[model samples]
Target: MLKDFSAQSLFMGLLTAFVGFASSFAVVLQGLRGVGATELEAASGVMALSVAMGVCAILLSLWTRQPVSIAWSTPGAALLVTAGMPQGGFAYAVGAFAVCAVLIVIAGLFKPLGRAVAAIPAPLANAMLAGVILGLCFAPFTAIASDPLLGLPIFVAWAIVAAFKRLYAVPAALAAFVLVMVLGVDLSGDPAGGVISALAPPVAFVLPQFSLAATISIALPLFVVTMASQNIPGIAVLKVNGYEPKPGPLFAVTGGFSFLSAFFGGHAVNLAAITAAMCAGADAHPDPARRYWAAVVAGAGYIVFGLLAGAVTAFVSLAPPILIEAVAGLALIGAFSGSAVAAFKAPETREAAAVTFLITASGISIGGISGAFWGLVAGAAMLMLLRLARKEA
Candidate 1:
């Protein structure tokens, strides 16, 4: 069933994969740091995640015979960096992955939770997604505040590229890179340059040590965040695109992959929403059936890139900070806008969605978990209680 690949489809697939992977590299580094990993160990973790996500994406797409792009959990990675890393070291972190993995597996195996998730109205789900994206988008503006002169040119370049959406569907990050180089922003301070010096053959695998306190404090919350924030929305994206593959199998595959990758110092692996949307969107192929191969291509690319983790890190290091910030901001703009539109569309749900967005944006923490996770819980609880009261009345 393989047809000659279209240049446009290939470009779209690669573009989506690259931006998705690059945007979350910092969080991956944070995951490594949390686990008491050396620089090389951390790089190795990134490599493993890249390889796992890519491979899984390819296999799933090929098997299902649909265009499916697998991506690292951007939100999950953010949670790890913001909460998991600082709370405890690698052993506890691995415990967190293990717990999350187990929960994902259970959810997949159990019919009820899957059905419950499926039963949630599309608008509400979209609203939740919108809230998540809005919080993510704020990072770029904050970066601009940190360095105006350095961030300005990149931001301008991104806006220009984004404005001309059809000429190039490529993410704004690529344009920002071009502008940063032209503007001569200093990048010597970034630690990405030491990648070569840090490179070495993979070390012996570290086994996870379990502790009740660590699991309760770190692992449980991580598991909740990864599932609620990442996995739930991931399935929603697939459904929204009209690809109704069995959620259980997808969850199992991702969880299994995460369990395996944990030994290599990787945090967790899950379905990607925005990046996966790249393959699912009209851009990948006119015939949705053939788009699966694009994911196959992306998967192969991930394997190759993961093998060269040290080299990639070194290259990333050489890039200017402004370039990274600009690219990340630009890449996420569409997702941010789309999510915002989704969040506020229904008057009835507007307040709850707003609450979710604000709490997530506030970046507050309780019990060592992130605000995003709590925000959802709080919003959902508020909605549920209101519903109950309405029914009683």
Candidate 2:
């Protein structure tokens, strides 16, 4: 295992972390803010999540000798976007994060719980995910209307890069955003302070406050999204690449880390799907046995990026909010497309899936509960009714 460390693994690991963090972090920030986190708190969440996932990835890959990658749940964050701020504000959101983490842990330790999560109708789950992200997916186009000069270049950069290499597209947009901030957006005070702050790392911990509303509105939906979209797919990706680690322990490990980070405002962290492919695939290393090194390196990279979360947050703040949203939206388009296709792919479940998508996308909240939770509830009801009718016929 020690001999498996190679230059290729190192390079691939660095690239994977860069892509993973750069791609969806803006969405994470947006979601955290949506749930009523202050900018400082949001930065803290990013930092905590990055470090936790990094440590989880490193520990898992090293322990199992597999290229196991971990990441914050982008779709789970999107679900938070639909969860309007609860009465307890960020603290309540943090409590929900803790609850979601505990659920994930339970799902790992208890097979039945895990199976229940897995039993969610694929179409409905995908549809709910699609609905959650629908608004963010519109950011790029809306950004064009709001700030054409800054937004157009970011979108154009992403499009052009995606044409050549899809993996690098979001990072390219992020780079363009940074460029716009430096060259285009005017700033006050010593911008150097922000840069310097990145060197010291950040700490903005909050005491959690639990409530029924946040548990129903945020925790349950977050757990479902993280499990259905990220954790399950991540395991499948590993199996596809011929790595057969037990899923239960992996989920448990990720859940433990997520739990630890929740106090600091992080949402769920789980197995990575896209970046997992990179770490587990031939690109990480031609020799499959030693490829775990790639994940280790990626984990280290994540920690390094984590230290700069405050700086990244500050940098993003310099731009108009619309522009930040554009970057996040660009990051999620792929996820949205994939979910939408999966939702409508099967003829039997298409109607139910459609119902889920529409309601979720509508952004309606009742009794302080997000439409995402309602979307799932409604879709399941429709499916049950439709099945009963067919049986009668």
Candidate 3:
């Protein structure tokens, strides 16, 4: 097992995991809060997701002997922010999350269901996701207006790094945000070193409360985004890297972990796309066979990070809420760009996609359902109408 271990792979693996976590964890925290999680619940949720992904990645890599990276559903987290909480609040959201997890597991176990999920029009999915994140993407500008000193530097750092190393921009901004938070603000009254506690906070359980509105608005859309935005691309990444493990089993494992995590306030965990390439590519190890070590090492690193989730969450709570939101927004700029490009890539669906983006960004809610669900419904309806008109033409 240790034969393929090398310093280079270890470094790369650790780097990939850290970058993945640091870059978007704020979004996860925000998403949890949006769904009405208390500070402790949000912290526990992040910790649960980190541990779930870490454990899943390690077990999958060992079992498959492949560089299988796992990540939280970043897009799904964005969805939560937009969806807000149901009248039933966090418990209802947890129920929806559980439903999504079950759907994913069913998709993995059933070939047709998996194909059906794959068949969701790519443009529509991208458009819906694009719309969901549009508001948060504007946070940096808003932050600057609200608090120039704390926010401007974070935005500047993100912009500068994005201009050079796009992948690391958010992490760079996070570092700057933390620095500003320390130097500019006063943490003197806060707990000195209690951030790193004797143990991570215990996971809080929420009993599932099912509702049609929550299921339709949150569960279904969450499943679609998780599958379309994360899992599909993750499979493609592994395939591009010349490893073709059966995707069905992968979905099953991630879904199972996601299901377990829901009770503890975590969102979906799935195969990773962006970070997968880092571990699966030749850069991890010249010999592809040895590259699995990169994923293994990354998994170990994530576990270590997960152990500090309470500390991270506590620190986040200490920051100005807008500052945290601004940082989260900056973290997702890449996803926003990617989704926008994908949403508009097809000329035929461009109008429909645009409609979706606009409606979702408008944040309209009907019958307690969020704009995201309506955006998908509206866009899909428009696409069909356009197709029918073309047929008649």
Best by lDDT: 2
Cα lDDT for residue 228, model 2? 67
Give each prediction's root-mean-square deviation over alpha carbons.
Answer: 4.2, 6.4, 6.7
From the highest TM-score down, the ranking of the candidates is 1, 2, 3
Please give the lDDT score at residue 102 for candidate 1.
Answer: 77
What TM-score does candidate 1 get on C-alpha atoms? 0.78
- Identify the candidate with maximal TM-score: 1
Task: Compose the digit string of candidate 3's lDDT tens values, residues 1-393.
Answer: 788887657856876676567667878988988988887677678888988889999999989989999999988898889897888788999999999999999878887745644444778767766676677678889989998999999999989987986655666776888799889877754431333333555567778889999999899989988876678667755665667678788898999999999989998999986677668766577788888888888888777777788665455446666776677576556557767887899899999989887987897866444566577678889999999999999
Candidate 3: which stretches are off by over 4 Å? 112-199, 314-393
Prediction 3 TM-score vs. true:
0.64
Cα deviation at 220, candidate 1, in Å, is 3.3
lDDT of 1: 0.65
Q: Give lDDT tens digits, candidate 2, residues 69-175.
A: 99999888887887889896899999999999999998889876556544567788778767866787898999888878888999999999989977667667878
Candidate 2, pairs of clashing residues = none
Better of 1 and 2 by lDDT: 2
Candidate 1: C-alpha RMSD after superposition: 4.2
Summed backbone clashes in each candidate are 4, 0, 0
lDDT of each: 0.65, 0.81, 0.78
Q: TM-score per candidate, in order?
A: 0.78, 0.65, 0.64
Better of 1 and 3 by lDDT: 3
